[model samples]
Every structure is written in C-alpha cells, then in structure tokens.
Target: MSPNTSAGSKQHLAHSHAHEEDIPGTVNLNAAEGDDTGYGQALFPVPAEDPNDPLQWSNFKKTMILIICSFYSFLANAALIGPSPYIDLWAEEFDISPTKASELISYPNLAFGFGSLIFVPLYLKIGRRPVMLISLIIFCAGIIGASQCTTYGGLMAARVIHGFGSCVCEALPVQLVNDIFFLHERGERIGYYTVCLCLGTFASLPAGYILAGGYGWRLFFYVEFAFGAALLVLAFLFVEETSYDRKSAILMSMPATESEKASEVMGSQVLAEISETRIPPRKSFAKTLSLWGRVDNDVPFFTMMARSFTYFLVPQALWVIASFGINIGLLALAYSYTFPILITSPPYNWTVINSGLFAIAAVVGYALAVPFTSSSDRLAAYFTKRNNGIREAEMRLGVMLPAMLIGPAGIILYGVVAEKSLHWVLYFVGGALSYFAAYFYFSFTLAYAVDSYHSNTSEMLIAMNLGKQYVLPNIALILPL
Candidate 1:
C-alpha cells in the first residue's frame, strides 16, 4: 500500500463522522477533529480513507494534475480558434468562397461541443484517465492529418476529427476540479483554468505572425501536434486514474475489542462505512497505464445522455450556457471574422497580416481580469461566514453584476464605430472593454453553476458544452447575414 492510503486509513479510523450533504453556498471548514485549513473548521464531501481518493493525494500531485489539464484546455481552444485568420488563405488555396472556408472553423466548433455527448458518459462509465488519454491521441492524430491535407474537404474532415477529440478539453478540467479541490478553492482554481482558456483566443495574434513569416498555416497544426504529443506523454506520467468509488461510513463511533456480546453490552456504534471495506494491495506503476476502466453498471450510456439534457432546465446551467454561447459567438467569433474584413478594407486599409493584431485587445482585457478571478470565491466565503457558515449559490453571483453590462456596451461601441468609420483605436477600446467583462462572466457563472448544484458534475458539463455549441453556430450565421 502507498503511504497516502496508509495514512488515510489511519485518519479514517480516528475520525468519528462520515461525509455529509453540503448546503448550496456554505463550506464546512472543519470536517475533522483538529482540522483547519485557515479558512474553516470543517471538511466538505468528507474524503474517504483510501489512498486512491483524489482528495487524499498530496497538494503537489493535485497541482500537477491541474496544470496538465489546464494546458490541454488551452491547446484545445487554441487549435479551434487559432485558424480564424487563415479563412481567406484557405479560400484562395482551395478556390472556395470565404464563407465556405469559414465553415472550417464553424463546423469544427460544433463538433467541439457535441463531442461531450460521447466522451462524458464514457468517462463516467469507464474512468477519466483512459478517456483523457484516448482523446489526446485522437486529437494529435487529427492535427497531424490536417497538417498534411491537400484538399479543403480533407482539411475539414481533419478539423472535425480534432475538434471532436479535443472537445473534452472543455469539460474535463471542470470535472477534475470538482473531483480534487475543496469548496473554498473551486472558484480560484476554476479561475486559473478560465484564464488559460481565454488565452487561447489570443492564439490568432501569433498565428497571423506565423503566416507572415511564410511558415504557412499548416505549420501551426504541426506545432500544435508536437505539443499534443508531449502533453500525452506528460499525462501518462502524471494523470493517474482519479475514479475511485468511495465507500460511505467507514469509521466506527467506537471500536469493539472483545466478544460480540461484550461489545454489544458496551454499546459500540458504527460511525463510518465505505463501499470497499478491505484495503486492496496497491497496483504497480505499469498497472496504472492499463486502458480498461471499471465499468459502472449503473450508469447506462443513453440514460446518462438523457439526464444531461435535463440540466438545461436548471436556471444556473442555462445561464452558463448562454454566457459561453453569447461571448464566444458575439465577442470571439464575430470580432475575429469582422476585424479582418473591416480593417483590410478601403478606409482603414490595414494589411492582412496586421489585421489580426486586434487580438491584442483580448490579451489586454483578459490579463487585466486575471487578478479578479478569485473574487467570486472570496465573496462566497465572506457570505458563508456572515451566514453562520451557511453558503448560498447566489453569493458568488454578485461579482458578475459589474461585468454584466460592460460586454454588451462594448459590442454597441464596436458596431457604432464600424458603421460610422470612426477612429481605428475605438475598435481596440471597445473589444478590450467587452473581453474584460467577458472574463468575469465566463469564470464566475460556471463556478456558480457548479456551486449551486451538487449533482453529477460531468453531466452538467455535458449540458454546458452541448448548449453552447448549438447557440454559437446560429449566432455566427445570423450576425454575418
């Protein structure tokens, strides 16, 4: 047995209580006797005694998992959006309409969202590690295939393949966070993931320069492929199987040292009990790499998909879907498509290469918002304390209020400036302001949803990814028309 498991078992035997249901907004700061992480006196989702419990893992191990998963989120998004500047280039090369070429980005984006339908349930039924590894391999294969494509059809297929493969990038990070982190830390950690995710949009700026250097668009895929391969290896080494089925109530309130009749006379009662009562021998390192995951007989595939759709009826889930969809469609895609056309036209006449420089607005905007990423968590914590340790999901929603109007206002500014042919700098000002607010909405809204509902998080993520995909394409179509 590993030292972690050994220690956890001892702790379990020592503690007097099992895990309890969490109130929506409040965290149990003190879960164990003499336990204090400085924030509270209780532990929420009381961790199991098994070393295999993700919560029982050391901080170093948890941080490594977060870093690797966050980077994957970054790469998946960068690959999806990075090729925006290449629409015109692909159009010319393939003798297709720019509209048709733009579909390369659009359709693949749909695939990116829909991919959750297949992968989420797979992870839930099988395990996170194997699914993640398989997805990474598929993503790398698609990237390599795209790098060598000679036709638009070939490229589109490759794009879809990669987009579908990497779609888990959107959901996996959030799921992993839910699995490993505590209630107080979720907001800040999710913020870190959101920052990396937002930074992916900035890839267009570098992609433009890459094209200007005469390396060709295919080189971008090649570079991403190289990174994907490296990440796969890193994941193999660091991303162990996090899918442990914890047994409930494993600790006894009092131990029985004598015969059953004597113990009964002593009035010893059970305090905890988990699913697996006996400690299993630890598997070797090689055993961790085995692709087979324990199949969850209870989680039927189609039923899980069906249940995920019900999250759409949830107000918080709906809010997250709308937030992601509007920002991605209106802010990211709309701006990417429009800036290139507008800046390179008659009055402004910016060179094609320089057109993508507008992405710097996004860079500046997200960078400014980074410090505030933990604001929601802090606000929630404060409210929880004020409420006598009872937390409400709405506690975090306040931080979003300031950013709510800012993004829409920026959109209006961009439109007016474009319509009137105003100063070029106004475009940058508008975009930066909009993206600034988008960061808060993007980060906090999702965090709020997770906090509000303690249901199957993986299923909620599926709904989130699927909802945004459907919403974005419609907006992308309507805006250009």
Candidate 2:
C-alpha cells in the first residue's frame, strides 16, 4: 500500500522501525499484505496516516505518562487491599463472618479485573489520557463513597466501584508501557511499576498497624481518599493522549514505490487516516485543559476491545500468565496472606497487632533484589548486540533460571514451617527468599512478552492483567488463608 493512499496527510512514522536493529522491527502489517508503502514510512503495526499513534511519542513524554499511570495503579491497588487488616474490625461491627468481611477485598479484586474488560479497549480506541482522567474521577467518587458508607452492602458496593475504576490503572500502565517503550527498555520499566503494584502488600502491613494505633480502620479509607484525590489532579494536569498512527512500520519496512502503485495497494489504509493535521500544538496546562483542545473522532473503541482478546493466542501472553500468576500467587497471595495468619495463631501466638510485621521481611527481600532488577534487560540487550543486532525474544529468560529454583525452595521451607510449627523467624526467612526470587520472574517475564510480540503491547498487557487478577484472588481466598 502506498502512503498517499492513506486518507490523512502523513504526519509521522511508527517507532517500531526506529530501533537500531535489522530483522528487528515489529511485524509489519502492511508489508504482510505486500503493500508498496515507502520503506521509510512503514511502521510495525502500520498505522494509517495518523500522527496520534501512541507509538510515535518521544521517550520522555511516554515515560512521564507511564510513571504517572503506573503510580495510579499502585495507589488503586493499595486502596483495595490495604484494608485487609481492618477486616476483623469490619466483621465485628457488622457481625459478619471473616470470609464475608474478606469480600471487601476479594469482590473488589474481581471487579478490578472485570473493569478492564470494559475500559482497556476504550482507552486503546479513545486515547489513554482522557480515559485515565475520567477513570480517576470515578475512582475518587468511589473512595469518597466508601468513606461515607455505614452498611456492609454499601461498603461492598463502594469497594466494587473503586476497584472497577482502579482496574484501568493496572491494565493501562502496562498497555502504555507496551505502547511506547522499546524492547530493550521495557523490562526495567515494567519492573519498576510492578514493584509499586506488588508493594501494596508491604504497604498494607503498616496500613493495618494504623488501626492498632487507634486511628481506626476508617482512617485508612480517609488516607487513600486523600491520595486518590491528589493523583486525580496530577493526572488531569500532566497526562496527554497516547494513541498514534499504526502504519509507519509497514511503510518503513517495504521498498518505496511510485505514487500510482501506492494507491493501488492501500485499499483500507485510507480509511484509517486521521483527519487532524496537528496534535493541538503542545500547550500550557490551562490551554491543554480547554474544551477547545479537540478530541479525536477516529477512536475505534470497540475494535480495540475486540482485538485485545486475540492476545490469548500469543506465546508471550502465555509466558506472562505463567510468570505473573506464579509470582503473585506465591508472593503476593500465598505467602503474604498465609504467613501473617499462621504466625498470629497456634504455636506462634503473635498478636494481630504485630502480624503485619512480616511484610517487613517481604520488603527487605524485594529491596535486596532491587540491584538485579535490570539484569534481564541488560542481559537481553547484551545478547541482542552479540547476535550482531538480530533480536530473539527469549534471551532474557536465562537471567530467571536462578529465580526459578530459589523461589520454589522458599515455598517448600514456608510449607514446612507452617506444618511443623517451626520458629517464626523461619517464616520471615522463607518469605524473604521467595520475594527476592520473585523479583526476577516478575520483572523479566513482562520484558520478554513485550520484546517477543513487537506489534501489540496492549493486547499482551490485557492478558497479563487478567491473569494476575484471576490468580491472586483464587489463591488468597479459595486455597487457604
């Protein structure tokens, strides 16, 4: 397909071909169809002539948007799970079973995942910034509602509302990260976000202790409410649209052809061209917020949603499922939930007040593992360079070998400790070891997926997000503690 056949005037090219490798660019959708779009213009996913594609943005812009959105994920997760310590209080006040009280966390968690089914494609279609800002507003209202609720149903509804809104933060950050980052840079960046998301457990330890200090469980809600409100303001002021033309890679990869030939090749490409000539000319905060800043009408909300489901067939997506499920199921759910409950009762007899202290072990473990967070990226990049610029997606998995053995060993030790009533310190040691090992699996799995599937990062993210949600809740509630 020739570039001119696309409907819109060419504003920019796709970033897939921007990297410094050959046989290296994304899978060219246009080239696959044997189009004659200029080799310089072909993009990986091969956007039509639109400039609004998320893939075309500068690294700094993408990074800022990613960091903000990922932090939003961190906060939203914290709000839902942080109140676990207060579940007993809620149970006592409402005269509900411990399991029912736990629903405050579990049901919201389910909502958290399902929310993505609704919003992921919307953001992919409509643009990330607008969806994010709107979601944050709804999230804020949900938090405020939870703070005011006096009944179990009211609180549960509020929690569901909050979880649903917050779910976007999780999926969107990964999607945005996939959208903008290069294969070499993605692992470390996603690792950073995953750290924040995982630390919700560690953060909740102290969140629980706050109740023992007499602030009461309601204070936790208040604290989360305050942070949500602040994050909302920050997002509105800082986030910009992230969707962009998907054609540059295809145009860039194919050899150039005459204009007449290009027109014959691009039958559907013209339909994809965006009408906007410029991106609202990067403006100041006040100007950016004005209703005058036009929204793109070409947003393909439903199409984006429909396409995301196809990620299940991608190999990288399965790896993400295994990596994310094992890491979160083990460290976040199995270890984090079980250790506290076990140590606080039976032979250990530790007080509920101090049960949350074990999260310190988890934090320490992950902290120790932090130095190695970028090892996968470095190793993959090094190997990619060694191959004379031929990039294979599996290069990063070697760095995870050490983690695979170490994590399962920690699990065994924890099981023994719980079964035999060993010293409580063994619990800490085992949990710490598992958490440290999980760092590698959690960090690199995502990088591998991003590198492997060069075209659709959002699709992979959707799968990973859903995987985490399904695994965490099942392990946390159904399996044991």
Candidate 3:
C-alpha cells in the first residue's frame, strides 16, 4: 500500500462509498452490444440523451477545454511562485527583512488556497464557466495592479488578489476533468493537468532571465498580466458551462450495429428512434459565450464551505493535503527561497540573475515523469477488466510505491547538501529527484482521491486547498529558514 493512502481508514470511509455502485470508484464496465462509448468498454457515468452534456462533447471541444483549463493552471501557479528570486530584492526595496519579504509570496500563497474556499463553492453553485471567467478577470486585475505597485503593502495586496482569483485554476481543472471525462480517462487527464501545474514552477527560470535582461521584478508581473489577459480571451470564447445534472437522465439509444446498418428498414428505424429521443441541439456560439451559465439553486454556498472542512477527517483527502503541502512548502518553496540566497552569497557566489536557474531541476523532473501520466489509468483499467469490470480506487495505489520511497531519499539528499553546502549540482540533483518522484504523488494521489470520492469531490478539493496552503504553510513559516 502506498503511504499516501491510509489502510486503517477503510472502515471509516465505508459510508462515503456505500451510496455508489458497490464501491466509490466501482463501476460496471460491461456494456451491451453497440453500447460501448468508452475504450471498447462500457462508459461509466453514461451520457444523457443530449449533445449539451459535457461527456457528449466532441473530442476537439474536449481537448480545447482541457487546453484552456491547463493553461489557466499554468498561469496561476507561475504568478504564485515566479517571484522567489525577488525575496531579497523586495526586502531591500521595501526596507524589510528577507523573511518579511518572503511573506509577499507566502501571504499570496495563503490566499491562493483560501480563495478555493469561496470559488469552489461558487463554481459548484453557479457553474464552472462563469466562475472561471470571473476568476480570470479578477486575476488579471490583480496582476496588472501588482505591476504598478511600489509599496510592499500595495504589492502584497495585489499579489493576494491574484493568488485568490487564480487559485480557482487548481480546482477547476480537476473539476472539469471529472465533469467531462470518463473513469478510464481520469488518471491520464489529471496527469496532464499536473504536468502543467508543475511546469508553472518553470516560470522562475524566465523571471530570473528577465532580471538578467535588466528589467525589474515589476516587468515580471507585467509579463504575467499579458498572458493572463490572453487567457481570459480564450476562456471567454471557449469555456462553456460544464455543470450537468444526471439524476433525471434518459438513456441514450445505442448506435446501430453492422447488421442493422446494412438494413434499410433498421436504418429508418434508427432514425425514428433518434428523432423520438429529442436530443437537444448544441448551444449556439453566442450562447456558449454568455456570462450566464449553470446555477445550482440547491447548493447552499456557506454550508458547502462549512462542510468542506469535514473532508479533512477522511484519510484519502488528508493524504493529498499533507503530500501536496509538504511538496510545495518544504520542497518547492524551500528551493525557491534558498537557491537565490545561497547562489548570490559567499562561497560559490553567482550573479543574482541566475538565482532562478534551480527551477530547471523542477522542469526536468516533471519532464521525465510526464510520459507515464496514463500508467495508473491503464493499470486500473486492466485490473477492472480482470475483476469482471468492477473498478476500485485502490487499483492505482501500486504505481505510487517507487515514488514513495525515492521521494524521501531525495528529500534527505537535499537536506544534507544544504547543511554541508555540498556541490551545487548535488543540490539540483536532489531537487530533480525529489520533484520527479513528487510528480507521481501529485498526479496519482489526486486521481486516487477523486476516484475514492466520486460524489463529493468539491468538498475534497476544499480540504486539499485549505490544508496544503492555509494550514501547512503557516506552520512551516514558523520554522527557521
């Protein structure tokens, strides 16, 4: 069992999974003839008799949705962590200590998680499309505001605004994957989102080069603003409301078989069947771009925020929170905060401009891990087949074993290298190895959590956001850096 999953909590989680088909992730993969809409298997969460259903969207449209949301994830995270090298710069400019300047990044990171508290509920209640666009607009406003700020307080305020607004990027992509994709496709698609989210760290590389190019950190925010605006345009055009109600679904008729297709009588019969089914027409382009989208009148907003905290009691959710928090705070931020300080000071002093170079470790780590994005999904599918089409969330747990061990080793190597001031390459090597291993944890833990809580994923995301960013970072900040 992967340490990320709690074996002891299985009995505790029974109530959550009890309502689903047998188990939480369990689904019947066996379909009647001509009913296979999946990978030659039965489609889980079967599509309603409507073109408007997100599941029934065309592949190109689906890909576009994925692209836009993944891009949002990238921009949000880039804006969050890209300013690491500037901790010292901001300290000097604002006449504050480096630790105080770090709060510019840290406070925003807190807002990033806290933003999910409101936005997740908002998206759940109002629909993903409008919430996404509104969030991007808020994010863009904050980024541009940061570009023009001079005081530490003003900049911090702006940073918090953007962080909070953009944070919905994290929740939306995961929610979209669940909204649009089927069970067989979850791991791979979530992996793709994870790669983009990870690559956001790669923003530090360019942020450094911008400084090297004689531009101040403000230009970095300006650059982010530019991309944020462009993403807004894309989102406005393409991201339709994905909130769907499947409770009253009508079963769609299966496609005609070969023998039926060969018969004119059956062909006419199929046409009549389709006509009688009354599938709604696809929304018009103008309508798709409208500000008004889905609204769940029944989803109580504040109650959802209160209930989200309850998910913290669940083991799978806690695992995601702890792992993500440790990776982001202890691993990602530690490197980001320390690399510049170490590189620009005594003993192998390098130019301040090269401080962000360590991000390449993260880039390379995620690159090496990207190809295996779908491995867990494939593994689970294989297991589901073997088990007579009954799928389990734990099936993906096996792939996390190697990463679980290697990750700790990398963390140890990093600590030793930092303590001894070992060769700089070893530091990066540790970062790379740790991050490479973390990529699996980042991708699969989330996939597994979503699989485990097929019904209440929003609450799980709320716990993840709050625990990782709000809860862990505050505790981590108290430690001596």
Point to the candidate with the largest lDDT: 3
Q: Which stretches of candidate 1 lie over 4 Å from their true place?
A: 1-32, 248-287, 345-348, 412-423
Tens digits of lDDT, candidate 2, 1-481: 3222323643344323323234433232222244333322223333333334444455556677777887887889888778887788899988999889988988888888878877876776666777888889888888889888899999999999988988888777776777665455567788888788778656577686787677877777788889888887777766765555445433542333233255556654552342222223333557445322224566566676666668767666876776777678777667665776897788888886787787877788889888886788678656655665445678788988888888888889989989999998988888888988888777777777767765566666777777777776666666653
TM-score of 2: 0.79
Pick the TM-score winner.
3
**Could you tell me how far off, in angstroms, the CA of residue 292 lies in candidate 2 after the best superposition?**
9.0
- Which parts of model 3 are misplaced by more than 4 Å? 1-20, 37-40, 251-277, 337-352, 415-423, 478-481
Per-model root-mean-square deviation over C-alphas: 4.7, 7.9, 8.1
Candidate 1, residues 143-201: lDDT per residue as tens digits?
Answer: 99999999999999999999999999989889888888766678888989998888886
Instruction: Work out the TM-score per prediction.
Output: 0.86, 0.79, 0.87
The TM-score ranking, best first, is 3, 1, 2
Candidate 3: tens digits of C-alpha lDDT, residues 1-481: 1111234632110000112376677776775654644444576666665667777776667788999999889989999888877888999999999989989987888789888989999998989998999999999999999999999999999999999889898888999999988777899999999989988867877887787789899999988999989999998888889899865544333342223465576567766465544546667889888898788999989999999999888877888888887877766657766778887777769886676677778877888889999899888877877887777899887899989887888888988977888888987888888898999988999999998887889988988888877655664675554
| TM-score winner, 2 or 3 | 3
Q: What's each prediction's clash count?
A: 21, 26, 0
